[model samples]
Target: MKPLSPDVFDAAQALWLQIRMFAKGMLLPWRLNQLLAIAALFLIAHFAAKPIGHWLTTWLRKRQGWTKWKLRLGILIQQRVRVILFALLAWILVAVMRELTWPSRSQLIALAASIATAWAAIGFVTRIIRTRLLRRLVRWFAWIFATLYFLDFLTVAENLLDSLALSFGEFRLSALTVIKAVVVTVVMIVAARLFSRFVTRKLAKNSDIAPEVQILISKVLQGVLITLAILIGVKAAGFDLTGFTVFTGALGVGLGFGLQKVISNLMSGFIILMDKSIKPGDVISIGDTFGWIEELGARYTSVVTRDGREYLVPNEDLVTGQVVNWSHTNDFVRLDLFFGASYRDDPHEVTKIAINASLSVKRVLAQRTPVCWITGFGERSVEYILRFWISDPTAGITNVKGQVYMAIWDAFKKNGVELPYPQMEVRMLRANRDEENAPHFQMTTSLKD
Candidate 1:
C-alpha cells in the first residue's frame, strides 16, 4: 500500500480517538452497581404506588360516597399514582446514569429535573389519551405541558421555546410574562370549570324557565369563558392594553345595529322571566296561532301548536301583541255550545237534557255547574246555549266541546227532543191586466178556445 499523506494520517488518528472517547462514555466503571440501584428504586416505587393508589381511592370513595362507582374512581387514582411513582423512578435512574457520566451534585439535580420533566411530558400524553373526547381537559394538559416545557431550562426544549417566544415583538416576553401566564392560566381554568358547573346546576333546578332560556344562559356562559380565556392569554403574552381600546367603540356600534334584534329579544326574555306570564307548559293564543309554550329563546319563543307544528315567534311580538294565556291564573275555560229545538218540544225538557249532557262529559268541571240559557227565539226554532266549564284548557277547547256535543246528541235522541232545521214560506199573487198588456199563459191554438 502507498504511504498515506500526513494530513490524512492526522485525520484518521483524530477519528480513532473520538471513537474511543464515545465507547468510554457508554461504558461507565460503575455501570453494574448503578443499574442495580436503579432497578431497586424502580421496584420500590412500583410497590409504593399500589398502596398510595389504594389510599387515594379509598379516601375519595368514602368522602364522596362513591361506593357504586368505585371502580372508575380507583382507576383515576391508580393512573395518577402510577404517573407520579414512575416519574420518581425515572428521575432517580437519570440521576444515577448522569452521576456515572460525571459525578457531581449539580449534574444530578439537573438530570433529575430533566427526567422529571420527561415524565411530566409522558404523563401529559397519557392524560390526553385518557381524555380524548374532553376538549377542555386536553387543552388544560396542553397548557400545563407548555408551561413545564418552558420551565425546562436545563433541557434542549427550553432553548427552543425561548427562541420561539422571542421570534416576534408581540411574542417577546420579560421574566414577568411567565409569572403572568402561570397565574392567568390557573385562574382561567378554575373559573371556567366552576362557572360551567354552577350554570348547569342552576338550569337543571329551575322549572319555570323554558328549555330555550336555559340553553341561552349556557351559551352565554361558554362565550364569556372563551372570551375571558382569550383575554387572559393575550395579557399573559405581554400585549399592551392599548391594543384593545379600538374594539370598544366598534363593539358598541356593532351592538347598536347588528345586535339590535338580539338585544331586544334578550330584554323581552328578561321581561318574560320577571312577569311570569308565558312559561313552559302554559297554553297561549296569539293572533290565529295557539299552542303551549315549549321554550323561550333569547331572540324568539318556541310554541308547539296543537297540530304539533313548532312556531318560532319573535320575542318583540310577545311583548307587543296580546297573548291569551289559558293557564295564566288557572287552566279553566268556559265555552258555550248553541243548539235549537222545534217549538213543539217543551223548552224546559230541552234545557234539562242539554245541561245533563254537558255534565256527563269526562273533562267538564262538575264544581262549576253547567248552565242552560234560553238564549233567543228564532222564527223556526228556540235557540238554547249550554255553557260548560273545563279545567284542562291546554288540551284545546274543541275536544271537550266535541264530547259535550256527542253527549247532547245522545240525550236528545233518548228524550225525543226534536232539533229543528230552518224552514221558509212563500206567497204569490196574479197580476191584473190593463188595456195595453196582460200577463197570461198563452197557447198557439184555435181562436174559439
Candidate 2:
C-alpha cells in the first residue's frame, strides 16, 4: 500500500478510497439484496407518509375537550405530521437493518436511514423557530453537520476550517472561530429580542407603571441585554477583548464627530421621559407640525396630525424648539376667540349672546363655563373675547374653535347682532378769503338729474 499525502484533501481522498474498498469486499448477492431492501423501504415510507399524516391530523382535530397543551400538540402534529411519520419509518428500517448480518451493506443502509431520520427531525425543529432567516440558517448548518457525520469526515472538516486563519494585530482568527462567533451572536441577539418582548409585555400590564417609565425601562433593558449578548458571544469565540481597546477609542472619536445629532437625540429622548414634558397622546405643535404624539422613540417622536400625516420629529428638536402641549397637565384646554359686533349693539347684550353661542357647542365643557369679556372698543365695532374650555384636545383644537365660531354666527344672526366692517366718511367744507393776497377757494361738483 502506498503512503497518502500529508495534505488535508489528500487525506480525505485516501479515507474515501478505504471506505469504498471495504464496501466492495462485501458479498455481491447480499449487497444487492440490501440495496433493494433499502430502496423498497424508502418507497414505502414515501408512499405511506401522506395518508398516515392525514389520518393523525384528522384524529387530533376531532378529539373533544382539548386542553391548551393538547391544542398546541395537535397544531404541531398537523404542521409536521408527514415529516414525523417519515422519520419514524426510517428509524424502524434502520433498526431492522441493524439486526442483519450483512456487515458493510447493513451499515450503509442503516447510515442512510439514520441520515433521513435526522433530516426529518431537523426540518421539524427548524419549523418551530419563528425567524425566517434564523430558521434557514439553522437548517443549513444542521444538514452540513449530518453530511460530515455520515461521511465520517467531521474531524477532518473541523481541522480544515481551523487551518484557514487570518491574523489581526496581536490576535488570530480561524474560519471556524468566526463562524462560531457569528452563529452564537445571532442566536443570542434573537433570544434577547424575545426576552425583551416578554418583559415589555409584563411591564406594560402593570397599571401602576407610568408609560414613560415603562418605555424607558424596556429600552434600557434591551440595550443592556443586546450588549451583553455581543460580549458573551465574542468571549465564547475565544477572542481577546483587550486587543480592541485602541479600536474602541477610535470608534468613540468617530461617533463624536459623525453621530453628534444621533447622540443628541438619544439624550433628548431620555430627558423628555425623565421630565415627563411630552408623552404619547399629548397634543403638541412644533413649528408648522401640529399633531398628537403617536410614539416616543430613542431617536425620534412620531407625531400624527389631524390630516392623517405622520411626521417623525427628532427628539432634539422637541427638547430645544418651542412646543405647544395642548393637553399638558390635563386634557382640559382653554381657547380664546376674538370677534367684533357693530357698535350699535349693546356691549353687555353682545357679551351675553357670545357666551350663549359658545355654550351651544357640544365640546364646550359646562363645568368650566364659557365667558365673554369686552376686550376693546374698535373704530367700527365692539371687540369681545370668548373664552371656552374643551376636555378633549386630541379631538382637535381648530375643529372645535370653528364649531364655536359657527354657533356664534347662528346666534348673532338670529338675535339681529350685525358684524361690523371697515367704513370711510368724507366731509366737504368751504372757506372765504379774508385778505387781498389770499388764494381763492373753489369747489367742483358735477350733478346729473
Best by TM-score: 2
The TM-score of candidate 2 is 0.72
Kindly provide the TM-score of model 1 when superposed on the true structure, using C-alpha atoms. 0.51
Residue-pair clash count for candidate 1: 0
Worst 10 residues of 2 by lDDT: 440-449
lDDT for predicted candidate 2 compared with the true structure: 0.81
> Model 2, 2-111: lDDT tens per residue?
44234546555656675677578545776677667767766776677678778877888788998877777667666665555555665676676567644554765666
Model 1 scores worst on lDDT over the 10 consecutive residues at 440-449
Q: Write the per-residue lDDT of candidate 1 for residues 158-209, one digit (tens) a residue.
A: 3333333332445355334564565566557556756876887889799997
Q: TM-scores for all candidates?
A: 0.51, 0.72
Candidates' C-alpha lDDT: 0.69, 0.81
lDDT of model 2 at residue 254?
A: 95
Off by over 4 Å in 1: 1-194, 202-234, 237-242, 306-309, 376-381, 422-449
